[model samples]
Target: MATDPYADPKLEGVSIRSLPKVSLHDHLDGALRPQTIIELADEIGLDVPSTDAEELADWFEDQSDSGSLVEYLKTFDLTTAVMQSADGLRRVAKEFVEDLAADGVIYGEVRWAPEQHLGGGLSLEEAVEAVQEGIEEGEDAVDRSGRDIRVGQLITAMRHADRSLEIARLAVAFRGRGAVGFDIAGAEDGFPPSRHRAAFDYLASEFFPVTVHAGEAAGLDSIRSAILDGRALRLGHGVRIAEDLEVVQQQGDSVLVTFGDLARWVRDREIPLELSPSSNLQTGAIAAWGKNLEDHPFDLLYQLGFAVTVNVDNRTMSRTSLTRELALLAETFDYRLEDLEAFQLNAAAGAFLSVEEREELIELIGEGFDA
Candidate 1:
């Protein structure tokens, strides 16, 4: 629906990139800068698809667009390969925060599986501290540049692996230090959140927040498991939850729809749906709805009062930023600045922060949009 999906636009006389935002579903390994990836890969003697930074970036985008989950996952193999050391983790996490700040994120929770990064002989706790150090450094840099930004870690466990409970303990151990939440990010179909019930129960016992990657690679059953078994407070790219809704009819500005129990609960509970527009298209998460931006159920969910929040699930792979995602949604749905602000508010509310902190972020968003 955008004149050019790649072009940036002004929303109600405001630059979308300059508006304050909250990123809740961002991935650490999935968001490397192309040049950084090339450099890091070279440092580890790993051969990449392209030596040129831009070429490598294009390669990632190309691979992700293949509509094959196996092909799409191969991109992460390259990213994770170079991130096996403390230095690599620190640098990547630092840049992840810096990039989010540059994209107007006031607060973000970056998620990555610590077990995947332990190949460098770093313990789970060490890897988390490394990322936390980088996050602090990035926060300081943003503050020096006259913009305040903050980021927290969401320690992730590979869904198909056996270390989820260990990762949960690691996440809870570093709560105030950096880690704010726990998640499982690998395969989501056969490996449902139900498999990690032990980890979820542990996190719940410690009162730690959990957000699961469901409704992306799977369907409604996966979403149900995320809530019931994982007790997920927020869903990572929970777009397919749209499948649980049945549209009755549209009467100019108001549409009547029927909600399945799952849909109704998710809506009534105001559980945030971390909807990544471009990534959803690339990963076929919205294939059931349609293939184009115009056909995305984002607007439908929003109109029906589902707590829909925009995100860039993989900035490099999808070649998108939160700003770009918001711009695309505005173009497709003809949304105004107020709508954009509402989405940000939803994200702030769903963030793994204290009520006071979320209120602070909500106030910051209001001030930014009013500028």
Candidate 2:
């Protein structure tokens, strides 16, 4: 691994970032370009921390690294403020795809709470439509540039809000449009997924896919509720699932561990853990295990046959990309090309797309890796 953390390394003479990838846990508000934030803030009369894009970028990195989820979320206040208007949503979505394309992401699902964007007098339907339009525009722009990319919207509900039922409907209503799944995201500790049973029930009834934010702020109980009550097909940042595993022994490179029933089920079922290395460290999601990237349970879960996928949960806040996250893990875990490919395959398998679409993504990844 290179000392330059952000450098794209060549594994077998192929750049890691150039390899085709799939993004499942990325947040729309979290992936914004710094320049776009300034422009959007100006349009909405919002005061940002800095007018210069580079300064704004550093500001985000500093605040998120402050080790407070509350402060981390305050950054979204400015992002969502600008995203209230249809045009803002569209531009952001478009640029979101472009950024992913530049990072060699072939497929991505952008998740955000639509209910939060209704403050600018936009209806739930209109907000979703605006995002969808931007996604399409972004895809078109990529195609015109001779690079291919496809993105889906994961309509999200804020867990602290009582309008999950409405958001669930909003997600299901746009099923074939741009929306691919439903999720609940917010302060995860207090607002367990059980609180949104009505929304999850409705989503289940409609056969909509769900991914819940769990185990990042709380523990096994929250993850249990996410899977049992929320019917989550995937975990938003379920890094804390490692808590369910009891280390029995360690001898040099080998260790014996036993998994609790919850961890066993999640691993056996291959439920994807969207492990954002940097975000998990900053947010204290992996505090139980350790405070550094090496302390992250990503390698433990991966080595134990758990479905672990690398991700950038909040790109701006974490000052990261899918490539950077993978690079960090490779540096920490001494991973190679095969290890990186396995993560991409796991993410493709966990994507909210239909099995057929997921298969297509898998093929793209295989081809890219082979190249």
TM-score, cand. 1: 0.97
Candidate 2 Cα misplacement greater than 4 A, ranges: 1-7
- The per-model lDDT (C-alpha) reads 0.90, 0.89
Please identify model 1 stretches exceeding 4 Å from their true place.
1-8
lDDT comparing candidate 2 with the true structure: 0.89
Model 1, residue 91: distance off in Å is: 0.8
Error (Å) of candidate 2 at residue 49 is 1.3
Candidate 2 TM-score, C-alpha based? 0.97
Model 1 pairs whose backbones collide: none
Task: Report residue 6 deviation for candidate 2 (angstroms).
Answer: 1.2
